[model samples]
Target chain A: MGGEFEGVVRPRRMRRSRRGQALVEFAVVLPLFLFCLLGALDAGLWAVQTSAEVSAVEQAAMVASSAGSSPTSETAPDAHAVLTSISGRLRSALFGTTIKSWCTTNASGDCAPDATQRCPTTPAEVQDVDGPRVVVVCVSEADPPACATPPPGQVAPYPPGCEDSPMITVRVVGFVASFVPPGFGPGASGFELPANISATTHTLRFAP
Target chain B: MRRRRRRGDDAQAVLETALVIPILLFLVCNFIAVMVQVTVQEQLNSATALAAQSRFQAPENAIDPSGTRCCGAPGMSLATAGLPTGCRYAAETFYGTMTTYTGLLHWLRATLCTSGGDSGNAAIPPMQPVAYAGSPSNAEVSCDIGSIKPGGTVIPGYVDRALNPPAGLNVVTCSASASLDFADTPLAWGVFWTPTLHAQAEALPPPFRQ
Candidate 1:
C-alpha cells in the first residue's frame, strides 16, 4: 500500500473493472444500435414499396384511359377485359390478383360515375393489416358498357357525348406490412401511403 | 500515464458514437424525402398529361358557358371560372389524380390553363401565340388546352407545322411545379433542406375521333 502512487497508479482490479464497464456500455448500446438499423430498413422498404404501387396504379389508369378501351357505344371493346390484363400485370408487380372492380351506370343503362353496385363493402378499408395486399379498381364506365350508345357520365339530364368521359381509378391500400413498431419511424395510418389514381383520355381530330 | 490515455480513448469513442447516430438519422430522413419527391413527381406527370388529353373530350369548338366553375375532389368543387368545358374536365382530372402528399407540397402556381400548356408560351408556329387565356385563382397545376376549329386559319397549340408536316396538328401540354417541404413531417427533425420538384406532360389527340 504505497500512498505515493495512490491516485496515479491504480490496482489491476480497477483496470479490469474499467474494461468491464466498457463491455457493459457496449452491451447497452448494441441493442439500441440494432433497433435503429432495423427501423431504417423498415422505412426504406416502405418508401420503395410505395413507389412500386404508385407506378402500378398509374400504369393501370393510363391503360384504361387509352382509346378502344372506352365504350363510346356498347359495340366498343369491353373495358373490363381490356383492363384485366393490365391489372393482372399490376398484381404481378405489387398488388394481388382479384382487383376489386366497381361500376356505376345510370338506370337507363348508360355508363356513369355514380354506379356503386360492384363496389366493395369498405372501398377504402384495408382488409388485412399484414398480408394479401388489397387493391381497388374503380371505373366510370361499366366493363361491357351498359349501353355503349351513352358513354359514362351521360344520362337523362345531360346530352350523350356532352357528358363526362369515362375514367379509371386505381387505389392501393395496406400494401406491404409495416415492419416498424407502434411508435417508431414514420408510418402512414394504414401502414402504406395509399395512392389514389384517376386518369381519363379524350380523342381529337385535325381539320383540313 | 496509461490510465489517462485510456480515459482519453473512451472519451473519443463517446464522441464518435454521438456523431454517428445523428448522421444515420439524417440519412433515413433524406431517403424518405427523396422517395416522396419521386412519387409526387411521377403522379404530377400522369395528372398533367391526363388533363391535356381530357380537353379533347368536349366538342371541337366547345367553350365553357358564362359563370362556370369546375370539378374538384369528390364532394368538393373548384371555382375555375368560365373557360371551356374541356378545361374544367382537365382541372378535375388533374386535381383528382394528384391526391397524395398535398400537405407536404408548397405549389409554385402558374396559369392554371395554358393554350398549349407551358410549351405554348414560346412562339413556334405559322401564327401568333398566346400562353394562357385565363386560370383558376387557386389552381396549382397548369395545363395547355386548345381546340382545332373546323375553319381555323392557324392552330393555337400547334407544335411545329414544319416538323409535324402537312398543315398542322394541335398538341395539348401541361406542367406543374412545387417544392416538397419536409419541414413539417415527423422525419423533419433530421432533415435540413427542402427540394423543389417539377413535372410536365403533353398529349396529342387520339385517332378515330379525327
Candidate 2:
C-alpha cells in the first residue's frame, strides 16, 4: 500500500521535467518583451509627427517663394490672403484637419530699419504711383482675421516709402502633437511642441 | 506534505518575473530616449535652415543701415550732381573716383557737401583735410555721393555686399535659434544618459552681377 501511494504522488519526477523549467523562463521574460514592443510603437508615432512638421514647413516655404513673378511685392492684405490659403492647404494635407493660423511681416527693426512703416501697407510711396513693395507673412496658432489683425490704432511710425525695401521676413508658428499616453503618470501629461519657421523673399515692383 | 511542497514551487515563477521586469523596462526606455533626441536634432536643423533662408531673402528694408541715413530718393541723375569728382550714381564719371577714394575724409566731406552744409565753415574745413592729402586718400568714398555718404553707408543694401551662397549666388546672413523639451515618458528618464544634438544652417540670396 505504501509503494502504491509513493507511485501515485511522484513530485520528484514532475520537478525534473523540462516543461516546468520552460514555463518558468517564459513567465520571467514576458514583461520585458511587452515593454520593448510598446516602446517601439511609441517611437514610430513620434517619428511620423516630426516628419509631418518638416514637410509642412518645406511646402509652405516653397509656396510662399513661388507665389508670383520674381521679386513679388506683397501687401498686408495680399500676404494675409496667401498665407491663410496656404495654411488651410497644409492643414488638410498634413494633419487631415484644419488648423488656426496668423501671418505677419518680419517688420522687426533688427531685420528692417523701416519695418514699422513698411510692415502694414503696400511697399508704395505714400503718394507716388510706382515702387517695389514687400510683405512678410507670419503664421501662428491664433484664429484667422483675429490672428492676422494688428493692435488697434497702431500707426506705422517709420518714415513713408521705407516700405519698398527688398528684405521681407516671414514667420510661422504651430503646435506639434505629443505621443505620450494620457493619464499615465505626472511625467506623461500633455506636452506643448511649438515650431517656428521663417523665410524671406524680395518684393515685386508694381507698375505706376 | 506533497501539497505544501507544490506551493513553494509555484512562487518561483513570480519571483523570476519580478526580478526581470525592471531591467527590461529600463532597456526599452533607453531606446525611446535615443529616438526622441534624434527627432529633436532634425527639427532644429530644419528650423535653422528656414530662418536662414528667411533672413537671406528678407526685403532690403529689414537690414539696418547702422549709421547710414537714407536721404531723399532723388532720381538717379540727381545722385551725381555735386558728388565728389568720380562719384557716380548711375553716371560713369564718378565710378573710378568713388571706388578709389573710400576714406573717412572723403565720406565726411561728401556728407557735409550733399546735405548742403548748414554753415560755410562746416563745408570748408572737412574738405580741407581731403584736398591737402596727396596721392589718393585711404578713406573710402561713395560712388553716388548724393545717394549715400560714408556716414550713411552703414545700411546694408541687398545688392551691395558679396555673400557666396550655393550655385554661385551671393546671399545675406541671417540667424535663428530654437529650444525644445523631450516628451514626458518613462523613457525620458533615459535622456540624461544620452547626448543631445544641436545644429545650424546658413542660406544665401540670388546672385547679382556687379
Candidate 3:
C-alpha cells in the first residue's frame, strides 16, 4: 500500500530551488543590513542619552551654585525622583534610567577614570537600557574664603564676603550597548559591548 | 513554450532588481547622513551649554579684551571681534566643537554677537533685536546678551534672559539650532532633506558673579 502511494509521486517541487543562489544571498545579506540599521539607531539614542545627562548636570550645577559657598550636598534628582515628582511626572527617561552621582566637594581628582566604574559597580537596567548613569558633580573652592579668627579684634560681619573664586564641575557619563560589527560604533575591533560616553563641564559657582 | 516563458521571467526579475538596487543604496546613504547629523547636533548642544556655563566663568565686568576672540574652526571662527569675553568663549566653544564636517554643513546664519534683544525675538514676536554694535558682519550663530550701550549705558546681560520662556528660572543657558546640508558632498545625490537640530541648556547664575 505504501509503495502504491509513492508510485504516484508528482514532479519534484523545486520552484524554490530554482532561485537557490538568491535565497542564499538574502540569508547572508539580511543580517548585515539589520546590524547596520541597529548601529544607526544606536547613534540617535546615544545623542539623546548625552543630551539628557548634560541637561541634568547643567541644571543641578545651576541650582547648587545658588546654594552659596556652603553647599549642602544637593544632588539633582535622578529619573526615579522625576518619575515620582509633580513637575517631573511628565519628564522621564525615554530610554533608560539616569544614575546621578552624589555631588562631592573638592573631590575632583578621585573620580574614576573608567566610565564603567563611574556609575554603580553593579549594573542596573530598565528594559534594554543600562542604569547608574548620568551626571557627576564636583565642587572646587577654597574651604573657607572668610577668616575664622576675624583678625583677633575686628568685628566679623554677617555672611562675610569672599575674595576667592569658586568653581563647580559637572560630568555626564553614559553606557550604551553596541551591537554593530567592527568598524561601526564603539568597538575598535569586535562588537557586542556597552559603549562609554562622558563629558566634563566646569563653571564658576553662583554664590548668592 | 515552457523554455520561452522561463526566459521572460528571468528578464523580469533582472528588471525588478535593477530598479530596486539604486533605491536601496540611496536609503542607506540617507541613513548614514542622518547619523552624522545626530552627532553634529550633539556637538552643537555641548558647545551651547559650554557657552552658557562659560558666561559665569568670565568676570562679570570684563569686556572682550581682544575685541576679537581667536581659535575656533577656521571658517567657523566668525570674527567675534569686539564682543564680550563670555561671548568669545561661547563662540570658541561652538566653533571648536563644530570642527568636523564644517564644509558639509549649511548652517543657519545668525548674528555672531548680539545684545539687547529684550524687546523680543522671532519666537515672542514684536521682534526687534538690539543691534550688534561691533560684531563682524560675516558672523553666523546669533546670540543675544541682554543689551549694550543703550543711551551710553551698557548692560552685560539680564538676570533673566528675555529670550527664554518667562518661567523666571534665572538660569544661564546655552542652546544651538542649525541645519546640516551635504550638498557639497557626493552623498547629496541621495540625501535631500536638510534637518535642523536643536538643543538648549540652562544653569542658575552665581550669587556673586551675576
Report the C-alpha lDDT of model 3 over A1-208, residue by residue, as the tens digit: 8866644542133365466747875885697677657756665565564445445544544443333333443333332222222113113432333443432223453323231222322122221233322222222222225545566665553124232234333333334333444466443423332222222232344334
Off by over 4 Å in 3: A1-22, A32-176, A180-188, A192-202, A205-208, B35-39, B63-82, B96-111, B117-139, B147-177, B183-189, B198-204
What are the per-residue Cα lDDT tens digits for candidate 2 across B1-210?
A: 766756666687667667667666666666766665555555445544443343223233332222222222333233333232111111211121122112201122121111111121122211111211211222112211111224533222222222212111133222222232333344455444434344444444433211
Residue A168, candidate 1: C-alpha displacement in angstroms? 4.3
Which regions in candidate 2 have their CA more than 4 angstroms from the true location?
A2-4, A10-35, A65-208, B1-12, B67-185, B206-210
Q: Candidate 1: list runs displaced more than 4 Å.
A: A1-25, A28-36, A39-44, A66-83, A95-114, A117-124, A128-132, A140-162, A166-168, A178-208, B1-10, B61-77, B104-111, B116-140, B145-169
Candidate with the greatest DockQ versus the true structure: 1
Q: Single out the weakest 10-residue window by summed lDDT for candidate 1 chain B.
A: B66-75
lDDT of each: 0.52, 0.35, 0.45
What lDDT tens digits, residue by residue, belong to model 1 across residues B1-210?
867988887898889888887887788677767767776777777777677666655554353322222223232234443445567767656776666666665543334543432222235432222333343233446564333545643354433334343323366666776666666678688777776666777766655332
Better of 1 and 3 by lDDT: 1
- Pairs that collide in candidate 1 are A73-A148, A74-A148, A104-A115, A205-B210, B64-B84, B114-B143, B117-B144
Better-scoring candidate (lDDT), 1 or 2: 1
Point out the worst 10-residue segment of candidate 3 chain B by lDDT.
B63-72
